[model samples]
Target: MLLEVRDLHVEFHTRDGVAQAVNGVSYGVEAGETLAVLGESGSGKSVTAQAVMGILDMPPGRITGGEVVFRGRDLLRLKEDERRRIRGAEMAMIFQDALSSLNPVLSVGDQLGEMFTVHRGMSRKDARAKAVELMDRVRIPAARERVRQYPHQFSGGMRQRIMIAMALALEPALIIADEPTTALDVTVQAQVMELLAELQREYRMGLILITHDLGVVADVADRIAVMYAGRIVESAPVHDIYKAPAHPYTRGLLDSIPRLDQKGRELYAIKGLPPNLMHIPPGCAFHPRCPLARDVCRTHEPPLYEVSGTRGSACHFWTECLNG
Candidate 1:
């Protein structure tokens, strides 16, 4: 495995209470494979990614337990400096908002070049050349001219491309892209996803794609891990998930996707909001909104039942769910 997040737990200390952001979540990605972490906002998807990247705010947030194992090494046990070395050189993250993630005052070239200069110890001139090469590699036209442009000078999709270029600068073994297509038009979203998929294939790097939109991941993800509240409710190959979801939460998400055949009909939406993390439901976090939820769901928490060698569902009535 390129990256294995084993039983990860993260908590945030807010004025209201301790937010159980990530509760014993576990997943892994191998080189040349794409794992899509699917969920709604505040489902702990981004928080988990931040913890793996070692960028979570410590005072307000803490990892109570877990092992972020990367290539046989436990990252949580490493020193700050050791983890810093691995961040950009070994693994990288592409944040959701490119505009905010990029430096507003700095030229894109300087920003991209910083990766090379800091990690590879290249001279400024050499790093700038490499930056242009990266931009061109990601299919950003007129890279030589745009390299010196500021983030504000580019369009939304273009800025996102620059972000992708920065993340790919070092050819990290793994990349976590959090909602990379958010706020873009459908056409541009498709382009960005294609670019990412192409680069991942060329580099044969493991990819963790975090997104709430199921449609965006349908074509790109090799496997799907659906999260609710802080836990993974269902995990399986992408085709299996789309064909037959084995958890109520996963079914709700799939049903919520807009279908052209149902254009005239009312769109389906999941009932009830996601539970408050600080006071998540006693048993299954999704029970409040689960149509199939039963008395057993309100008391005893269900263990992840193995549906197959490659599949699991954290629902007591997973068999019933699969039949439907």
Candidate 2:
């Protein structure tokens, strides 16, 4: 495993109350593998990624428990400076919003070159050359001419490619991309994902792709972990999840995907909004919206039940769900 997040728990102490963002979320990713964390907004997908990247803001946010083990070291135990050295060179994160993430004041070359300049200790001249190389590597046209452009000068997809280029600059063992295609059109989304898959194959890096869209990850992800209210509701191979989801929450997500065969028919949507983190319900957090929810679901929380050698579901009636 390139990265193992064991029983991770993270919470935010806000004016209202403590919002449990990640609750005992455990998942692992191997080199050359892609793990897709799927869920609605606020299901803790991004929070878990932030924790693993050592980028979660403190004061309001805190890691209450769990260990993020990477390359035989517990990242949670490392000092801030120690973690900093590992961030870009050892592991990198491609955030959702490229324009917001990038420095608007700096040229794209300066931004990309800073990785080499700061981490690899290359001189300004050398770093700039490497920056052009990265832009070319990501298949951005006219790399030499456009390296001087700011984030706003490029199209949305191109800006995203720059983010991908930055993440790949150091060739880290792992890359965590949080909703990389959220802002692009359908065609551009496909292009960005295809580029990411192609690059992942070339580098053989462990990828943790955080997104709510199941369709986007179907072709790329080896495994899927469905989260609900800060917990993993189901985990299985990508194909198995699409075939037959073992948790109601996972099933709801799969049904919610727009299908061409069901065109003109009303699209399926999971009932109710995701629960507030600060006041997650007792037992199963998704029970309020679950069709198969029972008294057991409302009173007793279900531990992750082993369904098969390679699968797990945190639903009490997983067998029935699988059969359904």
Candidate 3:
């Protein structure tokens, strides 16, 4: 495994109360494989990624427990400097919003070149050249000219491409892309995803793609991990998940997607909002909105039970869910 997150827990301390943003989340990704962490907003998807990247804002947020094992070493155990070294050269993150993430004051060339200058000790001239190469690699046209452009000068999709270029500049072994196609049109979204997939194949990089759009992951993800209220409710190969979901939450998400076969019909939406992380209900966190939820779901928390050699579900009546 290139990355193995074991029983990860993250908490946020606010004046109101502590929010258990991530509760015992566990998942793994391998080199050249894409693991899609699927869930609604505030389901601990992005928080877990931040923790893995060592970018979580401490004081307000902290990794309370669990291990984030990257390669053979435990990332959580690494010193700050050691982790910083690994962050860009070994593993990189492509944030959701490219506009805000990029520095408004800096040119895109400078931002991309900084990785080479800082990590590889390349001279400014060489770094600038490498930045242009990265921009071209990501299929940004007129890369030489656009290299010196600011983030505001580019279109939304173009800005995202620049972000991808920056993330790939160092040719890291792992890439965590959090909602990489969030605000783009459907056409542009496909293009970005296809670009990522192509780059992943070329570099043989392990990818952790965090997104709430099931449609986006359907074509790109090798495996899917469905999160609800900070816990993984179902995990399986992408085909298996869409064909037959083993948890109610996963089923709800699938049903919520707009299907062409069901034209002129009302779109399905999951009932009830996601539970408050600060006050997550006892037992299964998704029970309040689960149609299959029963009395057992209200009291005893279900462990992730093996549904198959490659699948698991944290639902007591997983068998019923699968066969339903």
Best by lDDT: 2
* lDDT values, one for every candidate: 0.93, 0.94, 0.93
Predicted structure 1, TM vs. truth: 0.98
Q: Write the per-residue lDDT of candidate 2 for residues 221-254, one digit (tens) a residue.
A: 9999999999998989999999999999888877
Instruction: In angstroms, give how far residue 269 of model 3 lies from its true place.
Output: 3.0
Cα error of candidate 3 at position 320, Å = 0.6
Residue 184 of model 1, lDDT score: 85
Model 2 residue 16 lDDT score? 93
lDDT of 1 by residue, 139-240 (tens): 999999999999999998999999899999999999999999987888999899999999999999999999998887798999999998889999999999
Clashing pairs in 2: none
Candidate 2 global CA lDDT score = 0.94
TM-score (C-alpha) between model 2 and the true structure: 0.98
Better of 2 and 3 by lDDT: 2
- Native-to-model Cα distance after best TM-score fit, residue 174 in candidate 2, in Å: 0.3
Q: Residue 169 of candidate 3: its Cα lDDT?
A: 85
Candidate 1 lDDT score at position 265: 62
